[model samples]
Every structure is written in C-alpha cells, then in structure tokens.
Target: MELTDLRKMRGKQIAVTNGLILTLLTIYFVMISVLDVTFSVLFLILGISILIQAILGFLKSDSTKSFIPIFEQVANYEKQKMGREWNKQRRMGFIWNLILSGLMFMQYYFSRGSTDHVFQIDFTFMFVITLIALGLINISLFLHIRKVDRSTSELDMKGYTWKSSLVAVVVGVVLAVASIAFIMFYILSNL
Candidate 1:
C-alpha cells in the first residue's frame, strides 16, 4: 500500500527471483559440465552481484510515502497517469523475461543435442547477458516506479478484467493445440 511497504516487498521479490535465476543457471551449467572452472567463476560473480543488489535494496527504505503533503489529494488523471506508467514498466519486464526464458529453453535444448556446439560462446554469452538483464529487471522497475509517484507507484489497478482473462485463456489454448498439431504433422510428414 505505502511505498515503504512496497519497497520491502519489491526487495524480497528481487532477491527471490534473482536467487532462483542464479540457481537455475547454475544447475544448467552443472548439468553441462560441473568442473568447468571458467563458467563456475562467472556464476560466482553473477551470484555476488545479485546478492549485493538485494542487500542494497533491502537497506534502502523510504520513510515517507508521499512527496506531496499528507492532506493533498492526487488528481484523478495523475493517478491514472501513474497507473499507466507502472503498468507499462510491468509489461516491459514481463515481455523481456518471457523472451529470455525462451532463449534459455532453446539453448538448453540445443546444448543437449548430439552435435558438438561450435557456436557455444556466441549463444552462451547472449544467454548470460539476457539472464543478467532479467535479474536486474526488478531494480529497473523499482526506479521507474519511484519516478512515477513515490507514494502510489507500487499500487496497481487491476489491468485484467474477468472477460479479458477468459479471452486470453482461450487464445492460449488454441495456439497451443495448433502448435502441437503442426509439430505432429511435420514429424508424420517427414516419416
């Protein structure tokens, strides 16, 4: 509700998400080759960066929620503008995270293939960069929120109504079935 509470919540979200990201990446690296010293060091650095960010975020707490006086009322349209700005940042984060996740899945799948990967450096570097970006996304979002309105930036108007949710579900299911059918068709046709 208040920015102070929101900051703490965001700090937790950042720490937890970044921790999980590191864990997943570490697991993948281990599965590929547990004893690779080069990658192990890189992972350690990434872990440290995430840890420091989390600590800084946790320590930096805002005491006051509103820059405006307590008695001042935020205009309705300014409230809408803040809502829109926060939502925009949220959407950006979600889109980028999804993109990075897809890239990671593709890398994981290909890395397990029989052929030796000649482009390992190129692909791995991209994945690592994207992973870092994903981990820092929360901090970027927090900055964006602070810019919008310290008091209410963390507050969200429900972007999705029930009707919109149902439509999204239907579209998702349709796309999934079509993708599966297409894959089956390709395999069967090749056979």
Candidate 2:
C-alpha cells in the first residue's frame, strides 16, 4: 500500500478506536447514574480524548485534496446562510457533554451521602442495556466510515470493486450490533 493509503487506514483505525472508547464511557456514565455508582474522573478524560480524536479525524479528512474544493465551495455559500446554525450545533454538543458530566458528578455526590436511598434495580439494568444499544449504533457508524475509507483506498489501487465495500459495511454493522447485544445481555444478567 502507498504511504497515503497507510495513513488513511491508520486514521480510520484511530477514529474507530476513539468511537469505541467514547461509547464505552457513555455507557459507564449511564450505568453510574442509574445504579448510583461513584463517578470516576477517568471517564471524563476518556470522553475528552474521544472528542479530540473525532476532531483530529475530521481535520485529517479535510486535509485531503479530494475534500478541500468541495468544502471550500460549501463554506463560501454556507457562510452567509447556515454558518451560525452549524456553529450552534457544535456548541450544543459541547454544552450537552458538560451538562451530562456535571450531572453525573452531582449524582455521585448525592449517592455517596445517602447510602440508604433505594436504587431502582430494573431501571438501572434497562438504562445500561439501552446505553449499550446506543454504543453499538455509534460503533456501527465508525465501522461504516472505516469500511468506506478502506474501499476507497482499494479502489485507488486495484480498481473498482463495488461488492467489496458493500460487503464490508454490512458485515461491520452486523458484528457491531451482535457484539452490543451480547455485551448488554451479559452485563444485565450479571448485575
């Protein structure tokens, strides 16, 4: 493979790993909240790392020549139209993360102070399961991005093979869902 191809592959791998880490941290947050577990700062660091990786991935993708012209054109037109809305969405994501983190910390403090408080066992279990499902969805998205990157690389080297990319996407999504379901069930049963 060419150096550029390798770089793209590496970036895709990093992005996927970051996505998995983000999903796991989100699941941890939900589990802690529902079960009244103590909040760990480590999850905050992980979440931040995920966000950093996501930004890095986006920047790296944009650095490629293929996307630059299109991005420039979009920027020129959107700057006068939807730029503020786009910025708002970005700000909202950051704000939501901050709020969630703060809430988790507050919950931890409260739970720590009141050991006698009864936690809802069923709801805790359900929350964890649902978070796992959401994690799987994110993982599926990451895998899809990776598959598309790899397919594009392969096409550049070995000519077009439409079926390969399609198959990769399908398999990646299937595995992501199956893994999530298995993990959720296992965690629920054990809890």
Best by lDDT: 2
Q: Could you tell me every candidate's TM-score relative to the true structure? A: 0.33, 0.31
Write the residue-wise lDDT of candidate 1 on 122-150 in tens digits: 35554655565574566554553454444
Best by TM-score: 1
Worst 10 residues of 1 by lDDT: 69-78
Candidate 2: tens digits of C-alpha lDDT, residues 37-128 = 42344344445565565455455442323343443433343233333443443344455455555655555555554445333345665566
Ten contiguous residues with the weakest lDDT in model 2: 152-161
Enumerate residue pairs that collide in model 2: none
Runs of candidate 1 exceeding 4 Å displacement: 34-114, 118-139, 147-191
